[model samples]
Target: MSSSSSHPDLILTNARITSMSSSPLPSNSDAIAVTHGRVSSIGPTSAIATLAGPSTKRIDARGRSVVPGLVDAHNHGVKACLARLYACSFTFSASPQDIEAALEGFFERNSGVECVMGGRYGSEFFKTYAGQLLPTPREWLDARSRGRAVYLREESGHNGWANSRALELVGITRESVDPKGGRIGRTDAGELTGVLIEDADVQARLRWPDWTAAQYEDAVREYVKVANGFGIVGSTDADANEGILKALSEVDREGGLSLHVVAAQTTPYGHREEPLDYGLHERWRELYTSDHVDASFVKIYLDGVARDDSRTAFLLEQYLPDPRFPESHRSHAHVPAETLARDYVELDRRGFTVKTHCCGDGSVRATLDAIQAAREANPARSEIELLRHEVAHCMLVSASDIPRFRRLNAVAELSPYLWSGESCVSHRRACLGSERVERWYPVKELLDAGTELAAGSDWPAAVASVNPWPGLASLVTRTDTSDPSSAPIGLDQAVSIEDALRIFTVQGARAIKRGKDTGSIEVGKSADFVVLDRDVMEVDPRMVGATKVDVTVFEGRIVYEREGAN
Candidate 1:
């Protein structure tokens, strides 16, 4: 316990600081002291004032509410940023003409570019407009694309639409076989229909030109700038890669990266029915540490999405059979059960924390079962806290798997941003049927079961914006932020505002193995916090997402300040 004057670097006074800690101090404090990028003291305004030295800067919070900076427990910053900067995307509500107009405008501007790519058209495009433009042929795309390859990733990121030239670039022909666990849409006469799913999409990406490392760095810088404006201090890059790592390291070294990041190397999955080589750890072993980067975690996608329009997600029960393929309607996992469990045991034995994308009940159970197997096979390492594995997008967890999360100490990385959105609900009902739709996201159940839970935006992939505020609000309101009049997705699963904030803060930090360093604004913890435009607790819960961030402080530095907030 050093006196504030001995090390004070900055002080914030006349503030309502919600420390998010269980300490005995007042919940709303008047002041806080920061030294060496960490909190040193917190108490009455006068108490903090007495310890401030002449060199210490002081910020007058003007009674604004301050809490630990928010974290996106799971995100793909590279993908999200690139999607906005380099791709041709339209809003979910945009009509086919709007999409065509955007594409025409894009082609007119970038005539020299070899390929046109970007997407996320909603289910309406597939369900209602399929006859008009969806099963669109190469001729339609070629007319607008000027012979350049055209690939549009669906909102789910698991499926794509490609023109004939783009398909030809990937060498897909009528004679081509659908990659195992993936599909290539074809007509009843067996002609290619230009739609690719699962592994098929991966093939397209592999053939597509890569973004230069410098471009990735620029995109990340832009993303961080946007995130800073939203009061985000850190995030977990769910789909980390060599290019992403290089970009983050460059920005961090240049003093441009304001957000702390835990980068997870994407794990290997099935390719054409055979598991890809399992030496990711060996190949990436040297990248285990870097400034603003943690490469110890690995990411895995257990299955794709399972909605009415996209039945690619692995499931415990069969989906209502498609008329085209009635007997094989249920989605399948990316990896076989035995192989997944074996890989889990191997990764656990080697001391790597893994996070898997689990959109359906079958995938969630499979992920948990793998962890349980790892625990059983590696008894010597069972108690290691650093081994806390994670499961992302627990979209449709089974009632039985709810307890397994607690028993296995698994972290549930939820994207409540989609929890109450209209498009999300429609997908559930159409793909999962009416009865199963009621079991959508089970956040409250997980929390009530004593399972650790954290929130994320899954940005660029979801149909909503990347800001976590709307997601936080959805956790409490369980209704659409865009249209509050819409029905709640699952009001029974809603959490309190305070608990929602905690999920975005403290719990998020714990999920990334940084609990002791930040999360809560306590003595000896990193001084990462946000000053809101209003007292979130006092505002209408439905309006929480609209609340602005007045100031964002990371590592004791004022990184972002709203122009008129002061």
Candidate 2:
């Protein structure tokens, strides 16, 4: 390696560097040297002082906070987590009348749109509109479309409401068949309720419309810029459809993206098959053929949200306290244990990393079983290091199975920020009593069990704040958004600030098998880190979320630096 004086790249000094390397919980150093985008050296200010030459671009951290760049093990990059920024949003606020008024204005702005796409909804906020008790559905959508066609998805992508005209465009009617894995909401009179769930005509629409790779590349650039502004350096582009691989590749070839993404190849099920569709198993193998442009991994959703009564998540016992009512409702299995095992074996055998979205104890257990079978079929180097897979939204895990995760070396890609507050409150409060809610988010439990844990926003679906500190705060405080007055989600299971930070950084990298690469500050590791405005640990644990990232780095390059701060 060339000496810093002769071939200086950059050197960050005076930082209270918190390296998550094997050194210790906290590092014994205050400065770090960066050359050729990897850490060149790290030691006390006096020790590595000789490495910084006059040619090096030095920065005075002035005791500012520095931590590993965040690596979100789970997130959706199919579109900007919030699909369309400029799209006319009819209802964004949390009230019915407010949504109606917003829709009125939206109609006026986007005069030519034939349908109101999804994103106009506050689930429980409803008022009578055209004989429908949908809060986000307003008369303006009906009036503007003039019965032409309008399809709008609920805020929760799980459900959608389409106007009569839009429904007609897709041949949807009361007489139309209900496809497998989807539901059409109806009234007692047997009239279609305009609400659709689980599945959609979206698959049909995608097949019908074909956009050039050029168009998609532009959208992706803006998407990354927007997310970077919010301090996201890494994320799992969960379950991207078949052709998306090519589209993302086009963008990469043109040098258009600044973000480091892992575009998860969609595990196409009965969802849809294309003309050139080589099918799920084959498509997966092709997707990862070249880990070009930094894209990585494959994503699969084993079940739906735990809050949905009809979601079919596998649960240990059906009679667990219902978060919607005092009595527990019978839980059902959506995907069988054997089937999941088969899929994992096929996917793992093909050399693709798998990340499954599982909630409730039953789903998690079933997933574990599948993973176990895969290991048995093809013995891994080590159970814990074998797959490096993760289970997302592990809302409720059985105590007995917690240790199994550590034994297997799997990670729990969790989202307390989603399950912690209001969304947790409005839907789950009534079903699960305070006692059950007390242990709702079991972060501490998983840590105790030796299972590695990572953090996620599950954006658009959960609508939780996107900042990592807020995620860390939620993990420790156990407080929900609606009632900040209450303690954090699982205070009993809460982790220290340092540990929570690990979940977002080094530990997160470990979840994806990137521990030796970018998670921590090491001599040969990429220069990826975040400069915080406030000291995370010293600040009130509750105020951790308020800590803003002043600068962000990825791949030994300075990707983001705040405007005014040093």
Candidate 3:
């Protein structure tokens, strides 16, 4: 350890420090010194006390546990934050009647709004309404929309439903054809349905009424506060647009956001069929070149989620066909492996990191192949190791591909929020059958193979809130978190509490290639840590989710202090 400077900016005393680096639990250290927003020294309280000076501020942690601040590797920052104030949400248990009631309630309040952007509708909406393949008639949505253009995103964020008015407003008629990597939902008779899938969903989102810069700023301000409260020090905005980047830049200038944010440019949404040329690349540069946003990554969707209206996630085994609507049970890769490999290579060659959404085994395999192709095509690029490009939403991976993640130097980002539960598990069972369902996530299998495992909440897209505690709990328990009486699913895949914590902390940072600076509490690292109400390491595995963050420190400054917290 480096010798501590006599004059430190701050001193934390009487605390249990879990560096999440050298120790699996809180180390024997009782004090730490911070200088210039980075850890200077950590050891016994008496040793650290010698570094304090007249100007140094000292805080007593009251025996609370301090650990590294959590990092979310795969998050939809803008969309998740905006959903808090701007959208209506539904849960997996919601029936057709429930959806109508929720929409009606929204319309009653915003009576004169021209466009409505609602979300959180579950994947089973069409299945429960008319069966699978068939779309709910536009008039059913029009009744609640009150003639206003309405577009509601499915819970998976891979598909959406629009009212007839919205379809007309966006110029989506019978003559409209599906764009590359996108699907326009249509009936067997060739009639335009109100459902939009893949790239089409992205296009519909682009057509929504744009929010003003000020509005974006407000939403982001609240979002940062919420994230701070949860002990999140950094997040990767996996899906970012020009407006989202601009808002972040504004927030940074105003000194509102204390959390570190890395933004990625989203692939093709506004226009159809454009050549991948220098002009397109320059547009990405122009959009995210702000001081606050790291625009060095590209986000691509290789396939849509299997749940909901768009069962487009590419799978090696065919899904069980719905007895009534046999055509509904199928899968397709939104971006073919060859097409994705070409783009992945170009982006990697240009020094851009890549993050793709791959929810199914086929998509995951294809993504791995694409990354390997990129590496082989650019064998001389030594920086490939530094570019830890990841594939998010790896919910299903073929056992044969488990070892490939480490071989390809790719991170396996899992959404623990959907780890194990009746609603989510039942959905998988219905689609993939009982035998395949047993191997849902294979978290332990990946970890045991020396593959880096990263956990993400997937935020507003998930059924639960964006709190990391529940996700961590689910990772270790692999059972129904809401009900204590619920049985465990895939008990063999459950990881230890320490493993779960590492996945949420250091492993997450490694996924984003930011481990050296901020992930752990060590000398020369950023002093981003959180104090908890209780020692989570000592708690019952099931109760870990109940542990609350009492205080959050970012860059040696206390950013969030819970009411009456020590």
Candidate 4:
């Protein structure tokens, strides 16, 4: 054990370190010394003792796994903030009635509630709503609200459930036509189903309620507090819209935000010309670089998911169950890819970075296309910083496109939480077939191909278990639903525990184009790291995901320390 010295800068001693700069396995006995928010030394515990000074602050690992603080890589900062305002218990809901009752009860107990928020009702739980596959209707919530607007988002965050009054306020009704790449679920007689799914639907609703900057700031503060408690040192925001960016600026001004914010703005469909004035990218940079915010880049969704064909996921060959819809043949190359490729080229030219939401084959193709175009457009810039460009979810990437990802130095942001019940269905079987399904989430293949990858919570957009452990476990075990114990899906495709941890840490930094700044415990790097309760390497792979955070250190600051840790 390294004795505490009179050092005040920052020293972490007696630690089992997992420096992603090296192999994923924990280094036997490493000590990390950080000063001025940068790692000053990382080596044997004995060596670090030499760097200790009278004013240095020391943190003894007490023999725990020490790795870079987990980076979300891809997520929605605003939603993370807003989600805390509504009923949020999702891991417990077993039935639709149970969910409705719980929500209704929450409403009843918390009278004078201003608005109903949150967007995590799984498909299995919503099946019985109104005795059909639909969203929780506005009618259901009308009784609970005394004109208080109740707004609930669907699991995707792309959709939502609003009260009748809320609907009337938005002026949405049965005759509403579906927006491009979005759906408004309807009843048998074509009546408004109250469920909005995808970009278009949400855009339609956005036209209705305009949130105030003060309210949004409050939401962001609440979210940041929760994150700090859970040991999250930073998050790579996927949706940094103008309004949300402004609110963050306010938080930064007040010095209320403590976590590192990698702000990535989304380019809404309707407002396409890339925002000539104060665009998401420009504003984020201006605000982030000024203080607490970290404007790393932007977010663009090329397509939808594997299950939903109506949106944008590229169809590989043909529609699985339905033969009439032509296979998007997206992986090979197409639109968003073509458009994105062009856009990326311009962005790269402008010294901007990016992370695109590419779920299906088509989406991935579009993302890759954008990267290629960007590189070609500016050939002279030689070493175009890969900028940690990421393909959000390579759910069904074509075999041919895998190599391109590596060549471009782009990252694949894997979301194993997709293993949840919502993803397991007859459609998956009928559309992808068991064999195809088995190959999904190709973690090993991408690793073998030499593609840098990162992990993300996609929080508020995904499940309740956003903690990196569940994600780490899911990546290693390839299990979410369908009894992973009996047999894991794509077992061969899964990576080792160490690799998974890296994907969530150092690799995540790379994805956000911040590899040079945070990510590892090396000297000159930010003191952003987490202390685990147990040695993650010695634990069983299955148990890894269930691990807890003992302490989270961000920029030499102890943001979260487990209750037991003194």
Candidate 5:
């Protein structure tokens, strides 16, 4: 072996490395060298040792496994951090009594604050009435709100339960009309129930107290620490408003960011009449573009969740009969087909990647249609083909549309956190029927169709933690890693461990538009990888979720090291 002209900055040896590269290395290769934040050399330990100078740092992996740093294709980075740090938090499976107890404790701790925000009771909580009933959601929240304006987001983040003070503050009176593409729950007499769905929830949340810049900065810092600890080197912030973007930009500017964040600026959801602020996206791109922050992405919600109580997801078939509405009702798209196609074409032309939230088969089809329109509209532009627009949350895609994903060069951004047979899945089955529920996720079929699959945690929305192991495990086993006794929802949809890893790594980076720079451990790419506590490939499929990150390295720098780890 010969040494290079310049010495390396860091080296790792005596470990199993999954490079995820197209080219295969020697069978005996087990070392990597990094210089100037990029992989400089990769070969056997003895060969790479010759490239190291006196100042180069050497790490002995001691027979651990190393893989490319994970990427989360869809996440609300700032919102998740804020909720973890300040909100009255509860699990998606928490009971009404549990939620009330959480709220009471939060209120007592922040006695002087006028507004309180927390959430995430399961969607089933709204329909089951498992606890004492009040006249309406407003009364139910009022009893536990301590006279403070309270707004608790539902598990799916598409609905909310607000106290009277919150409703009054947000100006939802008896005469208030439901916003287009959303609903305001009401009693038979047309009185407000303090249940806001779809755009109505957006309205209340926008009107709620805004956090200060300092608060946002703190949240951004905390988010980086949490994400890096979980082996995430990069993520796409699913919804980034001005506040979130500014915080991310400032952090990256100050050289405090350890994660690459592709900010998907928020666009109007469920409002077909509203125009997308293309100018706003361009302006943010110019102002917030930094070393680690890319602001050229945008997020759109084509429809809401598919759960029965909400009945907001745009479905191809009619939902099961419910007392709340007409028997023939199948939810509709937020934007008309023509409008969606037009917007998508323009966004695609402008070099912006769009991620549309599609929870139902109908919405999935509509999104694919729009992408097809964009491709046809700009047949000559190579950039159009490169834009890889995404259908976020492909919870239920019609069997026919599966091939369109690969044909349109689109990405299926799957949230593994929701794939398990959890309570929320049961709620979806109640409205969606057994046949539709049985086909949930369809991971293997998408892969077989040559569709690029990207994995995301959707943290703090449906899932409580950012840990990817459990979700990774669920991808292969189709069962909740947390509960061994739980049944698998769609066992046939399970993918292999190798496919699951690729989805979380290279595919995720591709979804965020950073595939060329990161996502793999090949030479000349960024030195971003994680040392695992165990070899996930050798572990029992059911125990994959129990895997942990012992050390996370980003751009050749060790960012997170577990305490007492070898």
Candidate 6:
């Protein structure tokens, strides 16, 4: 064994380590040595064993597969943790009775919580009860709320539902005018229906009871625990506010953070009538940045979701008109093109990586155009230093705009949680028509065009959890394991497992501007990797979602160990 000073802190022996490096390790390199929170050496078990001192901790993998720790390119980590820990929690498929029961149970269990928040009921809930005279959404919620403020988010996260008490508390009423980029639902009689869309939801949420600083810190800690259990060592918080960033900074400062966090600070969205506060990003960067937290990314929402009933996604082509929206109505952008371009230019000048939410082709094109505008505005910037802005949720991009991503050095951030032939896909199919729906997630095309594709779960929105396994599986299979009988969505767009893995790992690191540090399990990189219960590379692709992490190691330390796993 080597001297204590030269010895590795930890070692893993008899393991199948998939380094995920461009240059593969030698075939005989089955063991790994970690020193001072980074990969120190990689070689055969006999050779690596020689570097371990008397005090070195060693884990016998017993031939299990180990790969780079996963990265969720985009997710609302704090919000997802809050939802998992304290919300009423029900799925979109839950019936009215089921939702009511969930609310009842939540209220019964926690008598002191001032606001009852949860949800994710589908838009079908509104369509099903649109004209009903008795038990309107407000009335239904009112009955269940016990007079407390009740707020439930829609499945898309772009809309919300509130009881009468919540509506009153938020001061949204029949007299309330729709915000420039949002709408308030009302009955034919001009009574509020408790359905808040886009900016309206934002307005209500801004006024709702928010978590305190301590709660935010707790949420961050919980988020890390859940993410580590799922083998996530890095993630981008898609919409971080001051509170979220502060919590992340505090946790990291206290040595509580186990994963790398790239926080995209929130910007104005959906016609709240507020200008983008460019100074806030600079202030946050100075105040909240830590070793594990990067507050240099910004999130901008260009448009809303593409659900059939919402029809809020800004599309180049008009949606198939429904009874509510008759004439030529392709949804409009939240910010004007000129304004978006200006914002992009300023953000680029400030060296912030912008991630714009664009669900429809129109929004996607607008975002790309803005990126081009930024590039034109900054001609002197070198390619190496140019910030790679991302088009988040590039779900319904136009064919002509596909290659522009590579030309402009932009990332197509795909949320695989929304790629399956699930209820949301069906809703999109109805709103977008057959042709567009068939070409839904153009993953292969984007990759083939040389556009860097990054994967995200978009948890607490379309997905039940932040488990990247299911999303990774969906990227290759284009099918949901939960609904095996459903048809594949964009089957031709399915990429290889190798490509999908890269999207989740290396591409994610690139998106977060940490490609050289931690994405792969190469020597000298952060010793962040997961020991899997099965070899995902060799598993049946359909069964990949079931692949579980036996243990998760972060920065040379074990952060999570599944119970009963050896």
lDDT of each residue in 327-412, candidate 2, tens digit only: 44545444566666776776676655678777667778877887788777777555444666677778778888888888766778
Clash count for each candidate, listed in order shown? 1, 15, 1, 21, 0, 0
Q: What are the TM-scores, per candidate, against the unseen true structure?
A: 0.93, 0.86, 0.88, 0.86, 0.95, 0.96
The most accurate candidate by TM-score is 6
Give lDDT tens digits, candidate 3, residues 1-566: 45355688889988888788864423568888999889988888888888899888888888988888998777776677676666665665677677778788887777777888877776666766774322455666777777789887876677788888999888788899897657887778887678887778877777778877776777788878888899998887887777777788788877777787777777763222332453565576666555445677788877766653345677887787776335645576666567778877888878778888888898899899999998888777674354667878788899999999888778888887785445566777767777776777789999998888888777767545668887888888987576788677788989998899999889887766677778888889888899898887888988988778988988888899899886
Residue 492 deviation, candidate 6, in Å? 1.7
Query: Any residue pairs clashing in model 6, and if so which?
Result: none
lDDT of each residue in 1-566, candidate 4, tens digit only? 35454343788888888777763333444788776667766777787877888777778887878877877766675666565654434432435555556666766777766655544665434544556433346555566556776666655555666667666667677777776556676676776656666654666556655567777888788867677665676677777776777777788788777677777765654324332222546656766553657665777666665554333456565545455345443222224334556678767766677777766666677678778777667777655354657788777778899899888877888877666554443335556668767888788999999999987777766566456677777788887632445357778998888788778777877666667777777767788888888777888777776677888888887778788765
**Deviation in Å, model 1, residue 78 alpha carbon:** 1.3
Error of 3 at 146 (Å): 4.5
lDDT of 1 by residue, 439-506 (tens): 57788899899989988888777645678898899888887776868777767888899999989999
Against the reference, the lDDT scores of all candidates come to 0.81, 0.64, 0.77, 0.68, 0.87, 0.88
Candidate 6 per-residue lDDT, tens place, 1-566, comes to 34548789999999998888999898898899999889999999999998888889999899999999999999987997787678888887777788878988998888999887898886576776556524568877888788799999987788898899999999998889998767898878898888888888998998888888988899999999999999999999999989999999999999999999999998866653445788978999889989999999999988888887778889999998788786888998888888889889998999999999998999999999999999999978897898999999988889999999999999999988775436787788888998898787799899999998898888877777889998999888988855667678778999998898889888888888888888899999999999999888999888888889999999999999999997
Residue 149, candidate 5: how far off, in angstroms? 1.4
| Candidate 5 stretches greater than 4 Å from native | 1-5, 127-137, 188-191, 383-385
State the lDDT at 555 in candidate 1: 92
